[model samples]
Target: MSETSDAPEAPGAAGPPAPPAHPGVGRTVGRMVLALALGVALGALGTATHRTLWHGLPVGLLVALALTASTALLCRAWAGLGTLAAAAVGWLVAVQVLSMQGPGGDVLVTHPAESIPSAWAGIAWTYGGVLLFGVVAFLPGRWFARR
Candidate 1:
């Protein structure tokens, strides 16, 4: 006579296998902070990638695209959005108030208080990166919503 072997199974087994345990709070926070830093760093570096009059527009747009796509791929939705937001705010503060300069040694942007009409005439270029970032931030959300 031969003996038969048996295996254990869940009752009903109606659901898919469970996912891995969630990350800890500290780890999540750290990742979020890192994401924010990555976006900001991209902006700063991209800004200096080229130096010319109103160079911020093109460079900034490139930065926005790179930062958004990279961060969204590396980070979760909330963290990625937070990173983009921080990048935009940081860029604004840096160029507008801190008077940060581009590679060519000209200030990238100015404080709006200087005179919106005049200061904004050619100053919009500095915001291209942040604006693009904002626009890209929605893409991930939409894609995730489908799943």
Candidate 2:
């Protein structure tokens, strides 16, 4: 005769960890709001600084793009797709509003056709932010799973 037993592994056992539970609606909403606020701030700051040139290099644009990607990655990793979308929407809204001509006819981000060097920097910053954020949001699902 043979005896066999089936039992679950202990918590400390070496095995893949369970996936994290979905966050509650309230928590999700909170995360979204915070992410959106951060995104808007980044957008404003990026717009203001994207025109800087140091030794003929667009250092400000590069830094702004890096910040945008980092922020989007944090939102995605923290709360998944919805939070990321909220952040992206916030950034887009802020950027678009700021790019528009003000009552006095001043524009934070000028049209690329204006042929100003800063104008190209602004255009790159705008499109580059979107590309970086989208790349972070669409990263492989397994990469974000709990170990």
Candidate 3:
């Protein structure tokens, strides 16, 4: 004997829900903008903290680079290539602007060879962040798949 239910089955009751559609243009743009803002904020934070030392170790520089790497990876994992590019550009721009000598002759990022030991912190912060961004951006896309 066979039995049949009187109620109709719901359209999607037999399978997993559909994957979400890709983001709209406005949302994508907004995400990229937020990414850029985050990058700028990170640059400022790194610049301010890249000169600290503890027991003759450049702990501040290490922290700055770690932040840079984390930010880049976050961007990539969040929205793919566009956000990553925006973040990298924003970070580089902020770092360069901060590195310039102010009217008072103060510099956020000094030449590595100019100071005995701490000066290298600035150089590392500036260039190492760029390198980190580049490396994260170029990583295999499969690694960042949204599955």
Candidate 4:
């Protein structure tokens, strides 16, 4: 009878070693770029159409909220995590842009002290609505997801 080998295969010898568990750097970078681009486009449109409406809110908040909802709806496969991540990334990018702008830009200028509370309230209105849309995206069914 022939002797059987009992040794296990080496780590490097496995069939084409499974690709990295997390997405590749290239893929991650691509997603970030895509998300940033989407945020900018949406922000520009939102700013243009709702200049007065957004005047009461931080652009970062608006961009975050909008991108979150849109990403959630578009990439249902990723669901909650994807929506949150996209929103965060979009917000970061928007914040960077806002910071680079002059003091008169949407994010930095301060209105009346008494109006501070109301301004925050307005920001919450748009921000909450957008976030709610993202949450809805996680729900079942296509029609339901679309908003």
Backbone clashes, each candidate: 1, 0, 0, 0
For residues 28-127, what per-residue lDDT tens digits would candidate 2 score against the true structure? 8899999899889999999888887899998988898989998988888887888899999999988988888899988889777887757888779889
lDDT of each: 0.53, 0.87, 0.89, 0.50
Q: Which residue window of length 10 is worst by lDDT in model 4?
A: 44-53
Q: Candidate 1 — what's its lDDT?
A: 0.53
- The Cα error of candidate 1 at residue 57, in Å, is 12
- Cα misplacement distance, residue 124 of candidate 4 (Å): 4.1
- Cα lDDT tens digits, model 1, 1-147, are 897658766698758878767777897667666765665565555444423335344544444456545654444355545555665555454334434655786554444775633355234435555555556665747654423
The lDDT of model 4 is 0.50
Please, what are the lDDT tens digits per residue for candidate 4 over residues 35-88? 556655554444333323465555655664565556555544443345345644
lDDT of 2: 0.87
Enumerate residue pairs that collide in model 3. Answer: none
**lDDT of candidate 3?**
0.89
Relative to the true structure, candidate 3 has a C-alpha RMSD (angstroms) of 1.9
Q: After superposition, how far is residue 55 of candidate 3 from its true place, in Å?
A: 1.6
Q: How many clashes show up in model 3?
A: 0
What RMSD does each model have against the real structure?
6.9, 5.0, 1.9, 10.3
The predicted structure with the larger lDDT, 1 or 2, is 2
